[model samples]
Target chain A: MTATKEHVTIKGNKDGLVFLFNDHCEFPDLLSELQYKLEKSHQQILSGPTIDVHIKLGERELDVQQEEEIKKLVGHHGNLLIQSIESTPKEQIEKNIHQDLKIMNGIVRSGQSIHEDAPILFMGDVNPGGMISSNGDIYVMGALRGLAHAGKNGNKDAIIAASYMRPTQLRIANIVSRSPDESANEGAYMEFAYLDEDHMQVGKISELHKVRPVALQF
Target chain B: MGEAIVVTSGKGGVGKTTSSANIGTALAILGKKVCLVDTDIGLRNLDVVMGLENRIIYDLVDVIEENCRLAQALVKDKRFEELYFLPAAQTKDKDAVQPEDIKKIIESLKPDFDYIIIDCPAGIEGGFRNAVAGADRAIVVSTPEISSVRDADRVIGLLEGANIKNPKLIINRVRPNMMKSGDMMDIDEVCAILAIDLLGVVPDDQQVIKSGNIGEPTVMNPTSNAAVAYRNIARRILGDSVPLMNLDGKKGVFNKLKKIMGIG
Candidate 1:
């Protein structure tokens, strides 16, 4: 007896695999199948050390529940890879992007221009010359050295989050922010960006509600 | 060991493929086995620039993806015994290949050649990663324009982060007259900002376009100004201290005309 080996269309990327198949499969069934196969080879090394991945959905469409299911299976703060979106409609694609999370992976090279309008989650290092524009909250799970702009749509309530934040230039909408000087480039903690009554400021995510001095110590 | 050097410029229309073809042909003339691998995938132009597209039986994707054997994928140059062309797949995009897959392919070629020159595709995406993955060294090809230089600077950081350390630079399409008159940014300023070692400077030469149309690398045309620059870079690659080609003076009549019109 032959098992129905699903006609999985594998779209390869720099970091990992993007499996495009039917949305009819149950969430548990899909997750189990992926786990059964991936864990066989990845059992030795599949946690942490997030690898950036992109899912380019050019033709196929995915439901909201399936998207959420996939996200749950991948787990938060895990190795990130972009999934199919080109195939999905623009609004759906925008809605599917992690609004509260910034997804960036790989080294952001100089002159490499990047503009994302979603709440961003980056898994890679932001090198010197790159720039990102996002409307929602931006979170960096890695080092950010390039010019990054959060709340580009003039949302005064937005914040920029990073695991390592030493931006050459930071902007939250019209408000301009600068790095803490070349000598003060050590950022080992997660930082967040928000607007004050008249000034746009960034503070540690843990201390978002807490009040501190006008000028940050960092 | 024969080194694989990927000539990349992330921004499109910046002559990445043109520079790769010229440099590969130049290296072969120096008696080194050279293979130019076009990793541009779906938007390949190296074969067309080299005038070898019609002769291609397979491509770089076919060899690595196991659609064909390496020997079958390699298209030998008509005139040079040491030169070969590995074209890209016109049907597939950057996603068809990966960095690891490219590394595996280059590792296999280590024992057989003196140089594996990859023509990197535009963008910092999959094609870019695959091209640079197997490269022992990289030559970022860029114009004198600020945008190109800026992108080149970013590419340098990318290469460094990937541990391809100390990638040499090739500044192409330099119009010395423009720099002399302050119309264009001089190479010195570009070098100062990027702080990378210089490989060689190629002057603007119309023969480069004509040569491409004829399926020939400018370097093969001995008298072409740009060819002299590519030849100089090839020599520099082999540890030879050849002088850089000057912008205005070369054997080409077209080059001379450009000097008269102050266009080059």
Candidate 2:
């Protein structure tokens, strides 16, 4: 080997060890260098408690198999733990803002229908014969006496919540459920409808945080 | 110019004609020049209800077609002071007159009367549209029954879509005994569902059917509960702050007596 090139540089910060791989070098050369560096530091890593290691690929596009290979190589060192793998120049992703959350205010009376492709927050009563459907979650701040269909676009994770949970019918994705013949005294409590393993289930709004942690991202 | 009020109900037999005739008569009784226009062409009954069927030489279609002038078609109601009646043509259907024709007729009548009450035909069809064409205000009539209330709600939605905002609600034929027994929806329940301002609530009184049979409006009867309710509604239309009549007073007393007898 003509003077060994520094294809991988390891540094320690408050967060953990950072492995900055050189982009100009060949990917195989970079991976081998990273393995060598981690092995060399194996003794040094054992001296202390397990430390988090972060891998940073600068402008290097790695396939999923290559990334897994790198992760397995890093895992070979017992004391060295990989916390995260990131690319400096990430791929661009466009998020639609309108499909995130929509707010509306009014009484949806009989013969009126409201449809949306995104999550909706309605702040009024939905009388009998009125309908509200959405591709995502449906949140009503008032009495929901009419029909509400959530996850209409086949999003099974969608939910329906209301202050007064007396809906005539509730639909989520492919599941359909109707109100009981005698409306049970749900008692003015806030309630939500969600899909549980292909079955429609109704639960109190208080338990929504744990049931769907990702839905509480906002 | 005077205001043109459209009395409409989507379902038939919910007392749209009766409510229109009584409200118009009550307004006349209040010393206002009221003109009642029957827009239920081909199924005309306002004339018969108003007892002016014998005087209908010219009809709404005749006035719209320019065969007769507006004044020539208006039949004067000599019993009520300054009340006029315009009968619908029994031969011509609802399509005979367009919304513009009704607008023109109403505009002409607005200059001479304090109120131009248009009696809209049942259902949300061409006749209903024609009746509501030139109205400045709307009164949506509904009964306590579920079907009637549902139809009323649909009609209200249509009226709002037509840019007629804040249409007042009149709950007709409310049987207090049934409401007390939980068999019928109460006034508050109806109001909550409709979500509109309560113009008035008329109780279900046998006197109403009797008066209708005699071609006399229930408002003309001083002892009838519906007449008092209609009079109050008329007063409300005139911007008077009148309290709602005690709907439960008589029924509450009867309920108390029944409970004492262990018969309720």
Candidate 3:
């Protein structure tokens, strides 16, 4: 199809709204023109304190790398200048998740740490080197292979639950399980460990005194 | 239709350099044009592993930032005539190289070589992002240990999130004897969780370390179990249906690819 006359297209990247330049204009020139256009376009967007706008130029075949780079750069700054119709999505694991983090998946890998102000519940395993710290309680649907520390700020009432609980180390409030008993070799079952009258004890993950936490807002 | 593959493990010390050197060397030895881009930046050893560290006159950062021509920075492998090593700068930080710079460099390489294997730095940071910038495929290298496996799972998740479904696995340094002895997790045990296709299983061979010290890829030495495993992985990457090098002699083709990639 023939190019739209003076094409001004808008799209959503990981950062926010991005306006691309067609082959019609030069990159540096187009960038300057975009600033002028945004300055003149609408009032509501201009009313914001700051805005993030990502731009990429050249005849490059827009790939994921380019998209992610623009995003990281924009996010490094502040909010966007344009009130775009499209929105940049926050990470799924943290959406509307406050007070307690509910990571539906298991096996929190390395380079991924869930540091929230709430409790964390995993329906799966927390693999080694992956970290989990919470203010309320910590729960794992599967195994707890990685590091799980509950009551990080000294909430001794905090507890940890897992289906197959064999973590490298465990900590509740300030007390930590440096070395637990040898992991069982039989049918690996669920277990929950908590401060039983200030003494650490283990039982089935379901048998422990726990409250089913509803999702909280950010 | 050439491509670059970043062999990455989200966690460190999971055999990214070893696999990069071996796979790049294997492809070259197989008579395919290959260039190994060391995206590790600041801690590069692709040159050393290929036994060509002494010949690194220039680095990848230089080539990308237009300081040197791509041809000037490439160091030919000591063994394979077709293989070239592009080492990363030992002093510069990862941020010195942008994702676009890496993408431009790889795009320039796509037409010249049959394969470009990028030895990605550990973690999902800027370096990891830069390493994977322009690659057509990815290979997440990991070991049997829970730490490595967990990291591999996260790396796989990142790859999937990037829509890179062709990511394969090279479970390195696995001791089959230990698997038999119940001391180590078997290939099946790992496959059941990570759920990615198994390219090859490298038996824990001592030659891997020795080869690294001498600046030679283990695959260059035919005797090492690691070498055979690396070669099998190269074959698998080429869309060849080579069987898994089973020391116990009891693994299957379908089962290997079944769990990983969630494919048949």
| Best-performing candidate as measured by DockQ | 2
Task: Provide the lowest-lDDT 10-residue window in model 2 chain A.
Answer: A90-99
Q: Give one digit per residue, the lDDT tens place, for model 2 in B1-264.
A: 899999998999999999999999999999999999999999999988888889899999999899999999999999977999999999989999999999999999999999999999999999999999999999999999989988998999999988899999999999888999888988988888899999999998999899888889989998989999999999999999877776774567777787567565
In order, the Cα lDDT scores of the candidates are 0.76, 0.89, 0.75
DockQ for candidate 1:
0.29
Per-prediction tally of clashes = 31, 0, 14
lDDT by residue for model 1 over A102-200, one digit each (tens)? 456655667665667667677766655777668866667776767788778887666777888777788887899787665635555787777787486
DockQ of 2: 0.59
Residues A70-137, candidate 3: write the lDDT tens digits.
44433443445433223223443354454246556645754456765677767765666678878777
Order of models, best DockQ first: 2, 1, 3
Considering only chain B, report the TM-score of each candidate against the true chain B: 0.92, 0.94, 0.91
Per-residue lDDT of candidate 3, residues B128-217 (tens digit): 889888888999888998778877888887887666776888888887778888888778878766767888888878899998999888
* Candidate 1, lDDT over the whole model: 0.76
What ranges in model 1 sit over 4 Å off? A1-218, B248-264
